[model samples]
Target: MKRDINIFEFPLNLGLKKKEHEIEPGVRKLPDGFRKFDFHKEINPQNIFRLDAPDYSMEIDQESGVLNAEGIIEYAKEQADFISENHKEDAFNIILGGDCSILIGTALALKKLGNFGLFYLDGHTDFIPAHLSETAAAAGMDLAIITGTGHEKLTDIQGLKPYFLEENIYCAGNAETDDDEYVQQIIHSDIHYFDLYELRKNGFGKTAGDFLKMVYSKALDGFFIHLDVDVLSDELMPAVDSRMDDGIDYTNLREILKPLVHSPLCFGIEITVLNPDDDKAGSYTQPFVKNLIQIIKNKED
Candidate 1:
């Protein structure tokens, strides 16, 4: 059976538009400037998944504070249909996003097949609820939704919880500004987190190796790796919405991800929040996508 890789392009910015009470009024009033980036032009077209039809769509309801959860699920069902039709073959859903919120839809689609673990690599905890969020951005709540804890529409994707227990989730390279409530939740839950301070103390290679061993030991049938580019330092990857200087460098980032990509148990991967408006003559963003393609191609070889 041929291995299928589908790239779902999601470019909506609804999550960024939502206002959060916790954020300072000054930050909340800032103009929406991140949307100007052209992700389609920055990414190498040849490296992405090709489709006979459009692979991206969106619908947002600000009054209800519900993102296009229904539309996302519908698109996910389409991807599920494709998987059902091609069940004899191995398939991978590579979701390239408008923002991180799209992970909810991808997770929903994967849940229909069987159980799977999640590898959430990001700079923030992304576990904030809509009401408690410092910035009520839907992107910030992606992980919470997948873990079965946020808005009903989000957590109830496909009418089933899409993720494993909190213990099954793993976070790599996060910053210090994470919310206190979210931090407490992580401590109480089984989720594993590797902060920048910890990475610097242990070394990226060692930390990644340890994580891989731990993930493989869990006996999960499959796993999905979600990469939020903000996990990289601002110097290396400046195209993300949440620009922060405190993240892993490019070399270390690659070292951490290489083993996961090579693992047979990794069913799919998603790369989110690549904003071209912040890109430097397209020089900074292209290499990352190229490296990702190389990693996938290496697996093929």
Candidate 2:
């Protein structure tokens, strides 16, 4: 049951607003950044594909109430097509992302394929609607959009509303708990929510095991793991756009990802939001690439 890995590089940064000092969100450099550490060479992916992204912009679409709505939608369509054309049923796909917004394209591709579940692992809930988001960055509200909570233009792309059904999602590793409004969105929804505190209490390995049970029980086409590097502790991974105070460590990451990555039903996983600009020195990226390679290869060996 050794699945060959196929890597897709989607260097899109249209989800976030550029800071005054920066030209664009540094997340766009994520794919190349990983390459600097020879992540692809070490993993030895069967095929590698790269999708060029649009230039950075901060235009807020008045209709959709999100930044770069038109650009995001356009890219998502292209992304879906690219994925559908190259996606192999047997090989595991690893999508390297520019930001959390990359999920839209991945989600669209999955929806077109069949009934799929989502394992959303992020430090922030990313469940806020357009009005609630001060920045109106799609990256901040991607989960909500994918789950059919935002404007119809973004959520109902190609008539696929709610790319992933709420019941089939397991959103874990949220550390931003103080904002009741932010935390309550997912809590109220059908998504199985697990904040940082609850995750540790239930145990990381056990939580992953529990999620696997649901995947199996549903008899889904497959599940995709969404790994936002920001889910790592601030001390260990501070190169992300938004930094949380405390998060799970490397061991916890491995424990949670092992079973999910090894499961035969897994379609693939996506890595997002590890900004190279913030990690000018390869210190953080080095360990991240090393740990991730071990996790992915651990199942094969």
Q: What's the lDDT for all of these models?
A: 0.62, 0.93
Local error of candidate 1 at residue 261 (angstroms): 0.2
TM-score of each prediction:
0.76, 0.98
TM-score of model 2 vs. true structure = 0.98
lDDT of 2 by residue, 156-175 (tens): 99999989999999999999
What lDDT score is found at residue 89 in candidate 2?
Answer: 88
Best by lDDT: 2
Runs of candidate 1 exceeding 4 Å displacement: 1-6, 18-93, 299-301
Model 1, range 1-301, lDDT digits (tens) per residue? 1244555544544455422432211111111222123333433233343222233223455543545555544544564555444433355555555567667656765677576777788887777667666555677778877788766666775578644567777776778555667666555667787667766787776765665676678777678888888888888787677778888776776677777766667776777776655564656665675566656555321
Steric clash pairs (candidate 2): none
Look at candidate 2 and tell me the lDDT of residue 291.
92
